[model samples]
Target: MTCGLFQILMISFFHLIELSSQQETRFVYETFRGQENLYLDGSATVLPSGLLQLTNALHHQMAHVFYKESIGLSSSRQLSFSTHFVCALVPQPGVEGGHGMAFVVSPSMDFSHAESTRYLGIFNVSKNGSPSSHVLAVELDTIWNPDFEDIDHNHVGIDVNSPLSVGIASASYYSDIKGKNESINLLSGNPLQVWVDYEGNMLNVSMAPCEVQKPSRPLLSQHINLSDIFPNRRLFVGFSAATGTAISYHYILSWSFSTSRGSLQRLDISRLPEVPHPRSEHKNLSPLFIVLLGFLAIMGFCTLTGMYFFRRSKYAEVTEAWEEEFGAHRFSYKSLYKATKGLTRMDFLEEEVLEKSTEEISFQTEK
Candidate 1:
């Protein structure tokens, strides 16, 4: 009986180890445009097994939405997943635009049922607004709307409970493709990088312009207890994009995810080239530049001080020469008293008496 119990205990320990090994840290799914549902060329590529690339100029209504469902995560385990996508607007002038793209996590892995134009194409029409069903979408919206032009051209939003019943939780107007109510300046498509972090009951979304020096701060943050969305813990992760009439391509470059046990580690930003600044023409110095600026400022201060003293000295020399030529001229106290004689109180009283006498004499003369 002791030996049998020991064997069972060993088996149970091995089983637990196997379960722990199954949890996934990083998962990348890339689908190109054109080739067999994958949209754009050179935008999406699958390097070996784990690595996936989503590049520019890719679009397809029916592309292979690559997904990794069992990221080795159990219901009890908590995870933080982030997706990095490199999407560029296809340079088409007059094409009617479509919905942009989304990072979605739901109970279903079926991509066919997830189809909607403006609404993230991932809703069960059967359970349209039902909270019992599983649905969550983080949308990167590119299209414009009359109601919410308050939001930016490229903005991030979250849709929970159902896809049909959606709301723009967060959004920011980005400078890339510019347009007014009628027409917009279609500059070269600007690349957008977005980050979404979900920890415990908190969900935070942040984005940086591709050329920005620093990663963008969180644009919108909403804290909903995970229990509100899903009673069960594990969720399948995938991406969806749709081009309704006018074809706009979307691409996912690379993605990484991590769980509580540290299953998937994200690549450090130090490993990648620093994101270029949007205004590269302005040669603004970093903190190191402040030191040189301080030196220059000190030099400027010294030069200004020297110039002021030199001008003051020159003025003093000129004044001395003028004083010598003028033979130290002075105003005497007697001259000052004579100049102010009309201002004395006695002068005022005498003037008043004279004015009265003059008035009387003038009256007699007139009579």
Candidate 2:
């Protein structure tokens, strides 16, 4: 009876463990906007001149997708989105100036923001008072703004509603004195990649020199509740670039997203056809080592299970032997009273004293 009960409990526990391993459902959409094709082969070139801008406009809008009435992104669910771009500025003689780039998420998807020169990628508010109409942009700006030019070349900014509010919030000193305040170095084409994460009420942004390396801790964090900007719980995400007639090219190699409960899904990063880059080289353990570890783990689990069963079996055996020898029906109130010589408290005390004396005698004999 004990063995049967133990087996049933073990089976029930294992079934619950299996149920927790089910995969979660996740959905993803990706679009690339630019003049050149973004590819995986690491061959896409950044425009030396003309500006390129790509907007999701008609393909996939955020408001149409993630909402309580749409995809049902409630408090219990979470969503993650990220994109990768390669920005390189080739030497352009006396024309050293280059435009910066931005990643934007806003409530409105219909209207195109006005061009604000270097700030064109960010929202440009109309003359009317509608700052609360929509919120847009976290910019990785390279150029310096006099209003917030406390630092040097590479800087980060957050823009909302209009270009008037578009200025640097965080800036990194330029590596070279000549490169100070310039968004891109015209001589050497150095590439930069940025990553953004928004979960619950928090927003985080990070940047990496290459796609293979781990992203640095968020450069900036804001406490604004995402529910405010995305009241409907959906946001349109895309990139925008412009050059004020100063030509240049922009390219996005890849983009992807994952939900709080789901696995990562690949994103389409190019409107033009291009070859994919080779996978990044990183140290990972061999599959054989993983299999060996799994085998050892299984063996350890079995050993522990066997020990438990053996101990349980021993306890059951002892109990069964006691029941057989004593006979469950044999022990009665009269038998107990006779064993103690009388139904008196003094008789019971004397019986305990005799048991102690017998144990001492047995111990002395063994020694």
What TM-score goes with each of the models? 0.52, 0.45
The residue-by-residue lDDT of candidate 2 on 46-105, one tens digit each, is 323322223211211111111111222344344444443443333223333334456666
Number of backbone-clashing residue pairs for each candidate, in the order shown: 20, 11
Candidate 1 structure quality by residue, lDDT tens digits, 274-355: 2221232456568988999999999999999999998666434223566777888655434554688535547779999999
User: Distance from true position, residue 88, model 2, in Å?
Assistant: 4.5
Q: How far is candidate 2 from the true structure (C-alpha RMSD, Å)?
A: 32.1
- Weakest 10 consecutive residues of candidate 1 by summed lDDT: 179-188
Q: Which candidate should be chosen as best, given lDDT against the real structure?
A: 1
Root-mean-square deviation per candidate: 20.6, 32.1
